[model samples]
Target: MQQTIEALRVALNKKRWHEARYALSRARALTNALPADVAVQEREQLSALRRMYAARNTPTAKKAQQAKSKAVGRAGGKKPAAKKSTAKSAAQTPKPAPVRDLGDRFINRANLGYGPTNEAKGSRTR
Candidate 1:
């Protein structure tokens, strides 16, 4: 019974009207098996679910959802063109300095994997 109520709440929160209605019906069917006091509480919850289901299926709600979808271009409505901003330009900034390669220096110091030696392979004289 608790699980049924929880499932109904989850379905309602997710706006799954059919699933919520199904769960509500299940709750109603089990209410007869419960004690009178608990059954009354379950009946109140079922009534609230019924109200929510009706509200979500109302004509006004449907129209509002349709208008929202149309505004968002999901209902075949024409979307407004995006405006371009030209305040920032690439030519306004200065170019950065190029990077220098120092891998050859390490290679020369390591003497081509033969370990450190006195063999000067690079521009060590300069």
Candidate 2:
């Protein structure tokens, strides 16, 4: 039982969640079979470990870890490459064709060839 609790602590410290969970379960099972005095102490340790596991697995904790990793960068000591500008000169870019007004009667361009030709001008009565 003591050995199992020790294993749980080590796993938790190393951030090995799966191993920690397994150890916690083993400790819990062992705790059930121990004497009343020893079981109480082991239960306290298990509860604390459970709290630590829950805190570490929370969404906010994961987000904080992700943000920290991004800030640190993954390429060891190397700096990230600078992004290149994709700006184009007016001569190299084509201007979009101007849209013509189809008048207020047209609800949508796609509806011109399909569905009802025109929609009601105002709210319809029952």
Candidate 3:
């Protein structure tokens, strides 16, 4: 329907790819059900929209978009404000426990009774 085609056009203009794609699909479905004479114009428009979408998805277009953003960022764009410190004094704040080296503890697993010990591996005599 013309409404769907119009929706696709608006979406494309706004760079709303998901909406544009949905609208395009709907338009295609509507166009398919129409007679050849009525569908020709819609088919042409659909092809043009497809090409536009494809162009936007290309690497060059992506790079250009990134460059545009970078330019905007450099041109007086608002930077994130630094966070203010809390009211708590340094002495009032609880210190985190120091990290211990547990590497040596796990090295001798048999001594730690984790794996089979030497006595456990040997044959048991009554």
Candidate 4:
């Protein structure tokens, strides 16, 4: 808590370094047990408080965020764009078999001009 830190700060100011140190250590240990969002907000608030204490401009905080964004961008932004080789491919080589044309006759060796046989469904006479 701020009150505890303030009390510690007061103890330090009054030439009580050991007590202040102990209090600070206690505060530091307690910090880790804080909720995740609380830790983030605490970090964000610390920066804001530092800026405020320094009597800086409100726009300075915005600029700091922009600078952070710019830093992150610089880390990944300048990947050399990949270049595709635009040279055209040569025409495909012709097949070994003769290509079929409109006037060419198709020879189906598998079918061999054979068709399905029709079977009669009548009793055979002796």
Per-residue lDDT over 1-126 for candidate 4, one digit per residue giving the tens place of the 0 to 100 score: 566556555665464656766766665665666765676755454444333434333577569867987776455558877976555333556558976686645444335555532334332222
Instruction: Quantify how close model 3 is to the true structure by its C-alpha RMSD in Å.
Output: 11.1
lDDT, model 2, position 114: 55
lDDT of each: 0.75, 0.78, 0.78, 0.55
TM-score of every candidate: 0.43, 0.45, 0.47, 0.29
How close to the true structure is residue 50 of candidate 3, measured as C-alpha lDDT? 79
Candidate 1, 12: how far from true, in Å? 1.6
Candidates 1 and 2, the one with greater lDDT: 2
Which regions in candidate 1 have their CA more than 4 angstroms from the true location? Answer: 60-126
Per-residue lDDT of 1-126 in model 1, one digit per residue for the tens?
Answer: 768988998998788878998997898789877777876766787778768767887899789879987776445566767876665664468678998876643335454575665654443522
Best prediction by TM-score: 3
lDDT-superior candidate, 1 or 3: 3
lDDT head-to-head 1 vs 4, winner: 1
Candidate 1, 94: how far from true, in Å? 33
CA-RMSD of model 4: 17.7
**TM-score for predicted model 2 compared with the true structure:** 0.45
- Give the candidate order by descending TM-score: 3, 2, 1, 4
Residues 7-116, model 3: lDDT tens digits: 89899989999999899888878877888887677789888987887798799988988998777644466777887666656447688899987653324446557776
